[model samples]
Target: MTVDEVVSRSDLSISSAHEENLRAGPQASRLGVLRRSFQREVHLDAGHVLAERGEAIEKANLVIDGFLLHTLHDGPKRAIVGVSLPGDIVGLSAFGIGSMGHSVVTAGPASVRQLEFPLFEELSARMPSIVLQMASLEAAVQRQWIANCQRLTAPQHIAHLFCEWRHRLARSNGMKQVVRTPFSQTDLGDMCGISAIHANRAVANLRNAGLAEIRRGDLYTSDWTELEKCARFDPSYLRAVRT
Candidate 1:
């Protein structure tokens, strides 16, 4: 289906939904198997939409390269809800519903390891290990929401988000604290419920405090502690895992 069609279409079949379990987290071996099950590969340029509203998800993606924005749409306007970076999984809602909750579009040039919808359903049912891996991913996404909620304003929300995102990257990469932040001021503004101008001001204030260095579209968090404090951002509030 086309991107424009998603908003108006709703006649998809129920079989599009797949079964899922909470155990999918903290399991490495099962996730590898699940990752390999995907045969189709999607290479998206920046601005390409991965899934649109009401579009039946015949496949979901694992980011092989680049970033994705999970966005909520209202008419021609859009709002970014969450992000998908490397090692992060996207398309979880595709398994629980007939269509996506929002649109998933490439924030940058990206490629995804894509899996067949029916095969994914079968794997989830047959491999108990798959459930564990899925659970792990689901938990991470949950924590993001909790983290954003603690912020008193958009600036704090952005600050908390960066710290949380950095921590997740560290956990996945053997304590390496550096990450190449991909979003722009405008992107952050949308996710944080603020205007682009406000996002830019927040970034400037953060930089003046020696907390981060945003050059071009890349943001470098030199002192995460300071940034967190300046944002009044707290991590204890954002632990997406149910456990």
Candidate 2:
């Protein structure tokens, strides 16, 4: 649905964690001004390409729902460099840059409000704090990506990935213990830098140890504390980026 449609429905609200930050902070009134400047909204189906590597980004998309996969392509091989959840902006780097280094694709059905690059540039110039916030978010995401590629065991890597998602979802949607993940084993492997077979084995290990289990697109943890221990997860980084 469109942003106009979303705004008209009393039951629906802009549920972006980033937008929530904009609302809760001193710049809350500024958010309304920014929303008024929105050009339109775009809806995407699974596997739809939102932005392509090396292509100029004309607009920045504010994710309203679902997930996006950021991928790096090398010859015929591709790696998932990041995953964008609701409340994240997809092309914020395009503020001054000509093109993006990686491609953004829909991981599932999703919707995003479009803001033209020129308008974003103008708005950001008037509000320097937004730029600072975006930079902090980029840094946080990069740090998490580096941590994911660290020398952790297969299960530890996979478990940590799930734990991160769990925390992210909770922050964005008030999601509790259960996480509704729409990723496949192959997708999970790509995100964790493991093979599909290895990912399967790691997931099984998590389940057998009573840590967590991914069943029918949902991740359930018997004990969140125990699961965090297995993953060596520190949620402080996630908290630090929030307003």
Candidate 3:
């Protein structure tokens, strides 16, 4: 789908005017001006393919904001990885090896810092932080994959996801911060390894139970305690480590 469609379908609240300023400023990476010689930024729409199936690998993205999904297409089945929230890096392994595997697509309208693979490799030679962060992120992704492989039903998986989200947001200071969440039931369901109907039902159940409020392409937690119980989530997985 096009970026426009993602914008239309999502209830994301981004300032176009400020975004323009950031894009045009000397500090902005997209402009390639001062203070931004190494980093590049890209805005992706929901369902937009960051990299299509079997596409050449050129860059690995660090998610500065929004959500994304990694999917594998095996003839008739499409298996989706869970949501890649902010602070969660994507395409690490593929980029590390200098090749691409599967398709990395946007879960919704997302803002990302796109570091060229060559540049990343070059920087890693000098900056240890990049390598460390990539390693940590890769480990996280591996764990998620293992977890999904032995996962329960979709609803149960989603419950786990919700719990994880809470922990993630809390660790990132995102839970208490005021920012728009850009996820729909369809997208959430896709990440949870469940059907869209089931995903919607799960969200409705959360809302009716007064733990979260899911509406108009927005997902917000109203009662963290209740939400935690619904998902039976533990916060340990969301811990942040210095890289």
Best by TM-score: 2
Compared with the true structure, model 3 gives a TM-score of 0.68
Candidate 3 lDDT tens digits, 1-243 = 332332332223334533664666522322211112224677787778887766767766777767677777768666676456776556555644555566777766888876566655554454455456546755774586457547545545555565666556563464562224566676666666667898888777766766666666555765556655665555544444432
Off by over 4 Å in 3: 1-38, 75-77, 127-130, 141-156, 169-173, 177-180
Which of 1 and 2 is the better model by TM-score? 2
lDDT of 2 at 123: 67
Q: Rank the candidates by lDDT, best first.
A: 2, 1, 3
Q: lDDT of all the models against the reference?
A: 0.65, 0.75, 0.58
Backbone clashes for every candidate come to: 13, 0, 0
Best-to-worst ranking by TM-score: 2, 1, 3
TM-score against native, each model: 0.76, 0.85, 0.68
* Better candidate number, 2 or 3, judged by TM-score: 2
**How many pairs in model 1 have backbone atoms within 3 A of each other, for residues 3 or more apart or on separate chains, i.e. clashes?**
13
**Model 3 residue 24 CA deviation in Å:** 31
Candidate 1 structure quality by residue, lDDT tens digits, 1-243? 332232122112111221121134444434544555554577889889888878998876777778788888777666887777766656666766768878888887998977656656666665655554455656656566655655356666766667766665554454344556668888888888778999898878767767776666555776767777877755554344322
Candidates 1 and 2 compared: the better one by lDDT is 2
